[model samples]
Target: MDTSRREFLKGTAWMGAVAMAAGCMSRQSAAAGGASGAPMHGFRVAPMKRVRVGFIGVGARGTPAVKRIAQIPGCEVTAISDVNPARLDAVQAWMKERGLPAPKEWSRNGDKDAWKGLCDSDVCDVVYSATPRPLHCPINVYAMAHGKHVLQEVPGAFSLDECWETVEAAEKYRRHCMMLENCTYGEEEMLAFNLIKKGKLGEIVQAEVGYQHDQRSLQYNPRDGVFWRIDRHMKHHGNYYPTHGLVPAGRCLDVNRGDRFEYLVSMETKSASFEAFGQANFPADDWRHNAKMVKGDINTCLLHTAQGKTLSLIHNVCTPRPYDRGNLFMGTKGIYRSYPSLLMAWEEKVGDGGAHKYFDEAKAQKIKEEYRHPFWKVAGEIAKKVGGHGGMDFVMDLRWAYCLQNGLPLDTDVYDLATYSSIVELSERSVNARSSAIDFPDYTRGGWKTAQPFTVDEIDMSKFGFTS
Candidate 1:
């Protein structure tokens, strides 16, 4: 192992020690139901008939999400807010075309902060924000403060402080706040989750997951609200879009429940490709061409879990690589990987050739069918019918609504939002400090020790209306 990896292990060991000490110190207070500053609470609101949703940022992502949420039977898209009037008008027109009533518009003409008023309004029970990275924390905090549940976009917040604040607000206000990490809802991931629960992959030791898409055009395109993404790339130098793969990996590893992320070390490749892409695509006089990106073309982050499991996260959005999340889960008994989507389990399943071979398409299909998750069995077809990112987005929306309507806790709670998103800030700190180990915040306080692992089968789908 290299120095950085050694340092990361040491840092995680230190964090584990601190966590134990903190838990010991707070045992008495926790037993007495003390209001510790730590996020030691859950979101279990009273059961409601329908969940009314107010949308903020109806741009590229929000548009599809809004439409999907509208299709969910027990959810209402009651209000819409956006900085751009044209986008608001477009949403309203689209709703009208769908034979749905135009939602109450909540834009303040040119105010970028108009979403705050919508959050404060009683028009909606939930605030669905697909805003830029910097705005996630503020909007979520405000929404929760005003008694609205939140389903915000991924990498829940931008900075460590933002992560803490988002968690604090959610815990303090007793509202469900989930990061919309739709990738976790993918079919294969769900299958992996079920297999993990079944011990098909015995005692997961390590995994690799991340966003590896070449989003160069989308990043620098001024038309698609890429300016904000570009700005983030220019300012940050770590795993900016970590949640896409991290969330699914965490679910497999049982993060925030059985295994908490302890610490991470990161190193980044030089930022040459994006600069070259910019020069080739944009005009010589354009700032996008001349300006240099601070973020490297690729970032690799290694995280240690409290349970001694490890996670390798890769972030590369500017490169010319084909879209890949690199979802490779390993264990004592088996391994699973995406890209071509294959799995291998103790040579027994591979038919014992005295050498390793991945399961062929037919065998893999059989395995998936045999171990298909209960949640997918119930919701997959409808999700596919509704369609977003191969139905994962729709599945996420459905699950959120189902949980809220049933008064159950979210799968990806505030602690999840904080811990997963913290990689953005922590990895940068690590890379800038010569790949030093950085301690992860225990946003769950000491609750992860006893927190119940979320089982997909435990979800009460009978409470949900799955219209075909």
Candidate 2:
């Protein structure tokens, strides 16, 4: 309701394309013929499915997703939509540059409504919503209502009501509504999961992960670059973008699908960064944008799983920190993290500052080798060939199609999205209540216990046709 809050909110329309184009972090397809070297059982992955896709808000985060999806076989981007005519043309131009056909046509609607063509049109069966945080739920509900599946960008919904609303819509529509959270498929994170799963790390008891990017200057990033995160400076806190970091760590720790997030408490530092900027830019009535414009240090939210394990998640955009996630995994046996490098079971002695303290090349090699994912085990060499974020973007796109078409469950499913999102909502509540313990609401309604852990079976690598 305040002016500063409104400042970040106003640009959602203009930057819808830019934000969608950039994507929330980035995702992947493995190459044909699994790579050989390691000695493991037949870890055959299921072939990806072909899901016809339509895209909405192809701007910031959407641009890259469009490009990435196009590269992914089976899934096709049949339609694209955005409110800005210029943006529509821009996306078309990008498509042309990529040698893809131009979309059917451009449908224009006035400013009051989103470009609902792609979502409403029957031309596509699935819609990927890459708009800001606030629109995540609305667009998803719209797509599902129209009998279409939806893959929404993260921080899944802005509020608790929207969360429940999304689950309800999916139930009513009987359509797939998932958060396209890509971090779960990352190489290192998955490696951590494999190591932990094998009991190499012992009874894994606690963890930490986060989105540590610094975006203080995001406010002035051209007309087309504004996004939900910038506006959120004033709305709520707890580095809401925790999904990117947490999803992978959660997989590593088996949160939700295995271990469940029972309760969480959050605390956000004051918005000293936003206040300084407001003082510099606005001389009069800056207080109007006050609360919405800032949160102090970082939005730190901690969660305790139903099994009594604890994990800390940090989400912050205004601070200056290296972009990193997937942190220290401490168990009764050892700890594992990827920022500096990889280490493993008894690879290093405790108190020598952990793995970094006792770095061993042979142990590191074994750690890396032992935990390669099914996708990585088969396509490491090829992923480098058709690379996008270490080939993860490609693998994620293919897996999405593979899961839906074949009727397999996605590794990152609706509950994963909901639970990851709950961390954000609960963090906001925690910060607002003077850092109180905001009990997490089961966004899944009553579906938590029955959810499946995301996995894959024997994939048809013949399609991508592995080389090397």
- Candidate that would win on lDDT: 1
lDDT tens per residue, model 1, 1-468: 544234322344223322332122123433343453445335577776678899999988898887777756567899999888888987887788767777888874968788888988889999999887788989988998999988889878888778767777776787788999999999888888888888776778999888888888887876755588878889888888899888999989989887899889999999998889888988998887887989989999999999999999999988887888878888876788866556655444434452266777888889889988876776676566556788788778877787777777677788898888888889999999989999887877668888887676544544554332
RMSD to true structure for each model, in Å: 12.1, 12.0
Candidate 1 backbone collisions, by pair: none
Model 1 lDDT, full chain set = 0.79
Q: Residues 150-206, candidate 2, lDDT per residue (tens digit)?
A: 888877776666766665666556667778776666777767777777776777888
Q: What lDDT does model 2 reach? A: 0.64
- TM-score of candidate 1 versus the correct structure, residues matched by position: 0.89
